[model samples]
Target: MRILLTLILLSGLAAARANGYDSLPAPAPAVQSVPAVQKMKITDLQDLIARSDHPLIINFWATFCAPCNKEIPYFQTTVDRYAGSGVELVLVSLDLPDYFPARIAAFAQSHAYTARLVWLNETDADYFCPKVDARWTGGIPCSLFINNKTHYRRFFDRQLTEPQVDLEIKEMLKPAP
Candidate 1:
């Protein structure tokens, strides 16, 4: 009986390995400054809005999305230029949970991403979409711009350019009309 139990466990482990479930996480770079990737829930996002005084840009992306990949460079450049403008950029990954730490970390490191990286932990689009925005139809490469001070917020459901985001930020920061 013990032998049979041991054999069953070994076969399960072998199956997991074959399915890439045993993949190792990417190693941290020698001079990494960005904070480690974190798992985020809807409540955490609410907390972010409540605590921040600056304009926040939260971008939703995934590893498999082509438009999401294309917009990354623009997002990176925008973050670099606005590093001191009280503008906060967050890259929220919608990648599979199984790709966490390993695939995601490697990609971030390779790109030398400067913004905060987060993995949206919810799998159900119906449960997560409403929490972000009632009109959000669960699209990849989406972005949300918010200024808690003025209660001004906007949502983009497609790829965005750097200048477009910059202009929006400039407008959002203007004295209320």
Candidate 2:
């Protein structure tokens, strides 16, 4: 009888852990610095793109993705390089809603990333993936650069290097407007 009771308790514990009950505490709510660049739905982003006359760079990433974490510093550097410039660096985190705020806050605090970080809280990746970009295969570390109706550049399925980001930014900043 005791052995059976122990086995049941053990099974319950394992189930809880499997369900992420044993993970870190829930993340706090995110405080928005730039109200203009708040968490946006797909349609909202499309509208923003339509209205904005400057270049826009969007990075898709998640906390648990190793390559995503690795390239965060490079993204930060890119943001710093273009600070106060017409370019807008938007970071869209693919982390689930439950842990998104806390993880992103911690990440931003640690890395000192001043660019806007927004959570992509939509649960259906199948639906959201194509909305972001048809070329994206729902992969982390994907990026898109839109040059104010002149060009739309996308780098899907791989991490971006510093030079690569710099080159893209330079291309976007070319004198056409």
Candidate 3:
């Protein structure tokens, strides 16, 4: 009886292996077709901020802002170094709505900015600024760090350096209380 039962179980195991039940599940497909700059609403931003599995670094900038332009390369370097580390970088463009083809897209393509790029569609800085951060004065070159898992958040209203971002990442990685 034992031998008969063992043979039946072994055959079932072999059938399951043949049907791929022994292998790890496949990974989700990569998102390779995002728009260069999707129009993002405040609600969209809130949802992004609430993601708990990974840390997010959001840089607010515009095409015409000189300081914002200068900091792009540094942020790009951060993106490359932190790839696959559960750290997401988003360059939020505050460019005027009409500048997508003539300025925004051209500038992003020219710089080869590979990080996710989004355009905050709201124009009323006074109303939206407080939504982002109470201390924000609607400044370009601002960077916000959020780690929902740890409940850590930070806001920087000026341009950021590589060192500053490194420090911020360390803070974001600290364990939640």
Candidate 4:
């Protein structure tokens, strides 16, 4: 009888441990916040391009890339210049998820950038990159100027200057009809 009781208690203990209920409490609900700058999923970007009448300028960058750093101020200036013109300037960081918050905050603080900043958090680069553009080649310092479905312009594998950015924004803002 003693042996039977011991075997029952042992099995109960094993079951409790397996179920992870021995000590730990239930997980807390995730706290969500409104992001100061909106992040985009692949679908969200695609939909924005489809639905918006305004021109969308997207700049892909990384925190560690030197050319990206140099060009960010130019992007910020472009955003400011185009303010209230129905144009959207989006800065998409390709930095890894672990470094995202700090890098984004630091960049925003340093440049005083008002343009929306987003960290691309999806891990499957091969799948997501082509969705943005098959010609992306997974390169930083790439910029795209899109005006509806009919007009899409992309600059891959290059850094941009303030004047160049301004010129592009001006070109995008020009009447297409």
Best-fitting candidate, scored by lDDT: 1
Q: Give stretches of model 3 more than 4 Å off.
A: 1-35
Clashing pairs in 1: none
lDDT digits (tens) for residues 1-177 of candidate 1 = 223323433454466567764554366667874347889897897798778898888998765555776787787787667777777888898776776756776767766666788987776777777778887777667898888887878998878877887787777676665
- Model 3, 1-177: lDDT tens per residue? 223323433454466467764443333235433236777987798788885478888998776566777888877787667776688888888765766534565567656677788888776676677788888876667999998888889999898888887777778777887
- lDDT tens readout by residue for model 2, 128-172: 667767766665678878776665555555788989888888887
Task: Compute the lDDT of residue 81 as modeled in candidate 3.
Answer: 75
Q: After superposition, how far is residue 34 of candidate 4 from its true place, in Å?
A: 12
Q: Which stretches of candidate 2 lie over 4 Å from their true place?
A: 1-38
Candidate 4 local Cα displacement, residue 71, angstroms? 0.7
Rank by lDDT (best first): 1, 3, 2, 4
Residue pairs in candidate 3 whose N, alpha carbon or C atoms collide under 3 angstroms? none
Report every candidate's CA lDDT.
0.73, 0.66, 0.72, 0.65
How many angstroms is residue 7 displaced in model 4 relative to the true structure, after the best TM-score fit?
55
Which consecutive 10 residues in model 1 have the weakest lDDT in total? 1-10
lDDT for model 3 comes to 0.72
lDDT of model number 2: 0.66
Better of 3 and 4 by lDDT: 3
Best-to-worst order by TM-score is 1, 3, 2, 4
* lDDT (Cα, tens digit) per residue for candidate 4, span 33-52: 22354566777767765777
